[model samples]
Target chain A: MNRKRSVWFLTLFSLVAVVTVFYVSDRPSPFDGIQLFSDDTLDEVGLVETSSTNEESFVSKSNAFEEMRMEVTEKRSQLRDQLTTKVGSNEFTAEQKDEAYNQIEELVKIDSTEAMLELIIKSLGYDDALVRIEESDVFIDVVSNEQSTKKASEIIYQVKREWPEAYNVEVSFDGQ
Target chain B: MIGILVVAEGANDKRIQNSLIKTLSSVLQISPHRIVIEEMELEDK
Candidate 1:
């Protein structure tokens, strides 16, 4: 009877270990978690030449903003799916699961707010805009040839008005 | 804890950076040090 108990215990332990390994391997890296920008590789691209034609620059800026928006949307969706899985999985402790859900919720909220702000900016006559909300800070990028301080101020005002809780708001044009 | 990175299309401009920092600091009611503004050029794909 004692020998049979030890055998069963060892088998269960091994099964648990194998399952744990599989779970860990299948999970995405926490470092690769949620980001306002999905691809850090985009930062590696060199700056556009100042000598480039206005139209060409405008088109390029618009494209970049669009790509960034798409990335943000994709990442938000991915995070939501991960959150659902984490919540449903029995691997994490109750506290750990709650923390994971909260983090994902925060990311999704920020992403949604940023997307809404970007649309508002675009409707206000901006060609294209990218908005990233990290914690309490809000960053905005607008497609324009010149640095429009007036427009930037207006954006800041709009954001503050819409989301009074946002701690910081920074606005920049596409070109210097 | 808030960092804002803005990718622009042309040469870096100090004026824009300063203005952004100042505006963000004032509006957010946080010290300028708390707000980071990175201005990069947009890469064409």
Candidate 2:
């Protein structure tokens, strides 16, 4: 009768252990809150992300003019730095130094000329203006209501009167 | 001379008294008598 009691006790202990293991394994994981969140909350998160993206896009689009100017300025700055370094270093001869200095002066003159032209365009009743002069090209961008071939021709004539270099003049109108 | 000789841009526009020209003159903040606003004519090629 003692042997029979020992066997019954061992069987009862194993059954209890197996039941406890199954109970723990069948429970929901701690990270199951994904299902607990409402659909409204997820939609709100998506809307916030979308709105922020739109705001960034608008800012970038509106700053196109400024971005162009900044790029030009940055390029000029780098070129000027290189020229200045060339002038100060002994690797360049006197003639080379003089040439670099003249290039620097020419860059200054180009900046002033573009600025003056832009001012004149503004004085001409344009809302805003930008003038960019490359070696063989002239770019004139104006904010105005009228964008006509006649107006373009007149702008080219006016620019040629001032600069008079055989430049390929291109005129752009921004009605915004 | 204390005169402001201004040239309007992009050819001459024939307006009925040119309200824009008058507006330009008014905004200059100068004596009306000392302002000369002229619209540049496109030269015949």
Candidate 3:
């Protein structure tokens, strides 16, 4: 009778264990919310990804635009240098250069010879501007103080002798 | 000696009735009363 009771108890315990295992496995488990993303959430994630991609593309395009601008500026500078060099080398006739320069000068609005001379002197840093107008020929004297007197006189003499149209350079220490 | 009296850049423009005097004096080679220098006034740049 004791052995039969022990067998009955073991069978009951095994059956309870099997039933618990099957119930736990078959029933829906509690979700930790990790894998519970809805379709709307998925769509939001997709939109975020797309926005990031677009931002990246925008950055790339901005960079490309900057590169193109730099290239264009460089090309323009190169062309200006080439043209200035050609004009200086007498590739263009005096009249032709003068006419072209006058057109550009008018468009850009350079009125005074002094300003033009200053620009010419400044441009000597990079390249010379083929002087279209003879400053000394047009002006009798360059107004200069004691400091710039010598330079002014030198330019005057040079221009007076260089251009046949200019007979003399009347230089004065004062701008009268 | 009729010379044109002109103004200086930094100084005021002094127009002399007898311009030849100032012109000759400024030129220094000729007598002031003998030469004439035309006076042209351009605005300061």
Residues A1-176 of candidate 2: C-alpha lDDT, one tens digit per residue: 99999999999999999999989899877776776597866776754334675555444433565546545654675687688899999999999999999999988888788877877777767756778989778998876656999888877777887777737989998755
Model 2 residue runs over 4 Å out of place are A1-62, B1-45
Measured by lDDT, the strongest candidate is: 1
Indicate the docking level reached by candidate 2.
incorrect
lDDT of 1 by residue, A1-176 (tens): 99999999999999999999988889766675455355664676667766557777676676666556545554565566677789999999999899988988787677677768878988988877888887778888888667767878988998987777789888878672
lDDT of 1 at A121: 88
Complex DockQ per candidate: 0.05, 0.01, 0.01
| Candidate 3 Cα outliers beyond 4 Å, as residue runs | A1-50, A99-176, B1-45
Leading candidate by DockQ: 1
Ranking of candidates on TM-score, top first:
2, 1, 3
| Rank list by DockQ | 1, 2, 3
Instruction: Extract clashing residue pairs from model 1.
Output: A174-B8, A174-B9
List of clashing residue pairs for candidate 3: B1-B33, B1-B34, B2-B20, B3-B19, B3-B20, B4-B19
Please state the interface RMSD for every predicted structure, separated by commas.
Answer: 11.9, 17.5, 26.0
Docking class of 3: incorrect
Please write out the lDDT profile of model 3 over residues B1-45, one tens digit for every residue.
333344434322122323334344556643333333344567684
Taking the tens digit of each residue's C-alpha lDDT, what string does model 3 give over A30-135? 8847556766657667433345755554444434433433343334334444455655776778887776656545323322443455354334231212223333
